[model samples]
Target chain A: MSDSDAQNLREVRAIIARHKLGDLIFLVTGLLVLMIAVLTFIALFSHMLIDGLPRLSWDFFTSFPSRRPGSAGILSAWVGTTLVMIVTAAAAVPLGVGAGIYLEEYAPKNILTEIIEINVTNLAGVPSIIYGLLALSLFVHQLGFGQSILSAGLALALLILPIVIVATREAIRAIPVTIREGAYALGATKWQTVSDHLLPYSAAGILTGIIIGLARAIGETAPIITIGALTFIAFLPPSPFKEEFPYISFEWLMAPFTVMPIQMFNWVSRPEEAFQVNAAAAGLVLVIMTLTMNALAIYLRYRMRKNLKW
Target chain B: MQFPVTARRSDNTPDSSTLGYNYRRHLSERFIEAMLFLTAFVSVAITLAIVVMLVTESLSFFKHVSLWEFLTDTQWTPLFDNAHYGILPLVSGTVVSSAVALLVAIPMGTITAIYLSEFAPFTVREMAKPFLELLGGVPTVVYGYFALLFVTPLLQKIFPELPGFSLLSAGLVMGIMIIPYVSSMAEDAMRAVPMHLREGSYAMGATRFQTAVRVVMPGAFSGIAAAYILGISRAVGETMVVAIAAGMQPNLTWNPMEPAATITAYIVQVSLGDLPHGSIGYQTIFAAGLTLLLITLVFNIIGHLLRKRFREVY
Candidate 1:
């Protein structure tokens, strides 16, 4: 072989060797870092779980909280979280989905529309605490909702609205324009086409989006904390309109409530080891709830994608 | 004569008649469309209203305390009788902790991204990405709890004077929490690089590592930078972790081993207790929040702009 050919071969081999070395280094380091992170995550949870699980029973789920750490259960917080999630979903879905449809199908392509799109994108990035502040000023103070679950849900609904709108728009946009054209050809009105055909087709995607949004809202603490979600509540909230309402005639709307994270925060911040265990148990419950919701959403999205004929 | 008879019959049929039925259908369609528009309008109005209200309240706050005092003052004793309005300590704490988090996150996150995109087997890459993302999905409060219970104790075992809650503990946890943010963004950028570049380097006898480090990384630098900045924004805005893990004292010191207060932590601390509205202490929370909002907003805008500016057409 020519000297040049031999030299080229040698260089190629050296390059390959160096490449292998680099890959090894990168892979080892990356895996190490990830292992560290995952281990920390497990350790953190384990510390809580190990100490708290024996204490956690059916009664813990059913019982009211107490100043005595051992007797306290997160029943009020659990109830509060459920009510907030329901109210937030109710308020967010219609408005978010409607706004999404309009943007995707009916809105004019103009600078104003562009501005609104940009604004929504930016809104998704705004800190959750800012929304809490907004809720405090507008809902709690001005609207006289005080520190009620209604105010907290409204704040959360607003926080997740941008995500819902974005996801809904994507779902709506995925429907073929040919479907709308086909409806038009059949002499069906635009509204009928959207309601009867398009909405149903996009239903699964919209549902997945709503679930994801709900998960995010449920995990959020800053906004609710900002809105003065009580850190401790011994009693479950009465129905929003019941006569035994705590404060204003809109007593349900004015009553204070604790959420899972806020409760966890309160417990974790306490100096006692026992409270730390309680925080872990609460964290475990919160994580399980969120993960289950997310898993359901993923399953629904898979089914939707699979069933989409077009 | 037959066609004329048929046309007359069609006109006589009310449902088949074009004018009245078509007009009514058009009106109803327009009404629903109008309703959809109204919903869109309301969302826009809500977002704008929030911004307007925050700014208006913050403006009232500014009137009472000069911007210089708010920005320059190092002591944050708003709740106490001796109220020092300086926001510097909180600002410095936020910056330092976020900086530390970025220090740990960027190299590791970028390398992981590189490995996933260029080096790792497809199965490995797929599994790693989602598993890393689980970190992001974990609530910040959990991270805070972990930092306090797990990380702080572990650190104390090694460094005896390490405060039970220190900035290092919080920063370390924050860094772990943001790994997914950085890795996912960086991976997207790396994936966006043209395959031809990698192939060409390989054909020229460059090894995979060389191609990735010299060609792919430089090609994806802008995107990686954007990811890093976004991670910083997330760390800065993060409240629960820092609030719970990094102690509440707004000390001006730069030591990572010491307990320090960040802006978000300060807000959390103050808001936990009942401070009536219009009090200087309560207003200070808004002031600190405003500062945090502006910092994050600027970072987000810059990151967005960079992504837009450098977006590869192909």
Candidate 2:
């Protein structure tokens, strides 16, 4: 080979090496970009834990809000959150599941079905605060639910209805067409097939969806705040038990309440450092609650995918 | 039922009673179907209720304040004695914060997507998935706290004159909070691009980076645009971060260093205070909400269309 040809070969190698360097630089940059998210997660969690760990105690769970920062606790808030969650689950599960079944199995492919599908997708994107406005007008005023636990529960029920419906539909869709055909060949009616086969098979997915929806609802502060949930409640809602012949009571649903997030918001807005500590503690609890639910959903999804054959 | 029975008898088959249809079961099935249909219709009812509520309340608001003034005025002090019902300040604040957030989220999110979709090994992808989910799962209020206590202090170290509650801190935290959302969606879009396209790029002697950026990105452009639109919607609608960290003072400015209120933060601030129903203060929130809904709806529709287009293409 000539010396000039050797020089051309060397230049070609140099150009290829330059491109490889660019690739290496981007790979590092991409990893660093992704690390921003991971690092933020660590920082936020540690920040809350450090600020809040000392505030966690048995008494902290048993007491109520107070004028004094050191004495205030989350008793009313947690109880309210629990009750609202119960109401939310009760209202959302049946409606969302039923809707999912209808859309997936019953509804004909027509204009109305298309409209409903589009509406559900768009509803998922509506801001949570707007739901608050809807509740404030419709439930608080027009329906006279006031700022009660039932109103807040119903509001969240509406907010998460789309999520549950989507999850349920996706789960139902995953079941093979052969299952439906087999059910039909067995002389089973549509409802019978759905009850025996479809609903049973999709139960895990539906539960995961419910847990996720409830988790999202639990941390939501804006809608509850917009519906006029009090920030400084010192007493819990009336319990759902009676000492009379009828042992179940419904009065608790109409009682005013404050949730965990709202309580944190109240404390965060306060002008004192002690209150900030309380807020951080409450935030830590809230984060744990949501993260645990999401983790459970992920685990359930993994197991479902692993266990199912078709 | 009659036709089937007569035909069977005419053909000299066995009595049809044994195979007769059960009308009771049929009726019950119809009832259940109707019930489920109603359940599905509830979502439509919700959409109607939202539009109606916002419209009626905003109608009352516009009754008192002209639409032109609400659109063009620079001030937005509805609670004070000298009330000016301009929405520009809130709009400007929302715009600036969302811009700041997108500036951080779009590039970071796109690069993260490229890395995850094109380059990450299996174990790396598995580990990173949960990290992203956890990041997305963290509550906005907690993010608000972080922005207020951690990020602001860190920023203040670099720029001493930065206020304790500036949009810059809140916007940055908001961007970090949004990273998981943007990256996951964009990654899904890029991964959906067929493997043959990447192979073609590789066959042409292109590097992995070149294939991902030049071939995969262009192939997935519509889907990525949809993801960016979603990130924008989330930023615009985000409340607690700006409410907690960015001061709720509605200032008409584009500078991220100065404190201002986004439409969401403004609504939260008003809700935190007591304003009687039917009062102007109350009505203002609805008007602001209507504006927010309109903005997000536009983005959502565009995103939905883009998603549909990309799904069809692939």
Identify the leading candidate in terms of DockQ: 2
DockQ, each predicted model = 0.46, 0.61
Off by over 4 Å in 1: A2-8, A240-251, A303-309, B1-18, B194-197, B214-223
TM-score: model 2 vs. ground truth: 0.96
Q: How much does candidate 1 score in TM-score?
A: 0.91
For model 1, report DockQ: 0.46
Error of 1 at A77 (Å): 0.5
**lDDT comparing candidate 2 with the true structure:** 0.91
lDDT of 2 by residue, B78-98 (tens): 999999999999999999999
**Per-prediction backbone clash count:** 1, 0
CA shift at B256, candidate 2, in angstroms?
A: 0.6
lDDT per residue for candidate 1 within B1-314, as digits (tens), equals 00111112344566645656666766787788889888777667877877787687778888888988888877878888787888988988898888878887887787778878887887887677656655667788888988898888899999999988789999998988888889999999999999999999999877777898898988887888788887888888888988999898998978899888998888888778897877777777777778888998899888888877766655
Indicate the DockQ of the complex predicted as candidate 2.
0.61
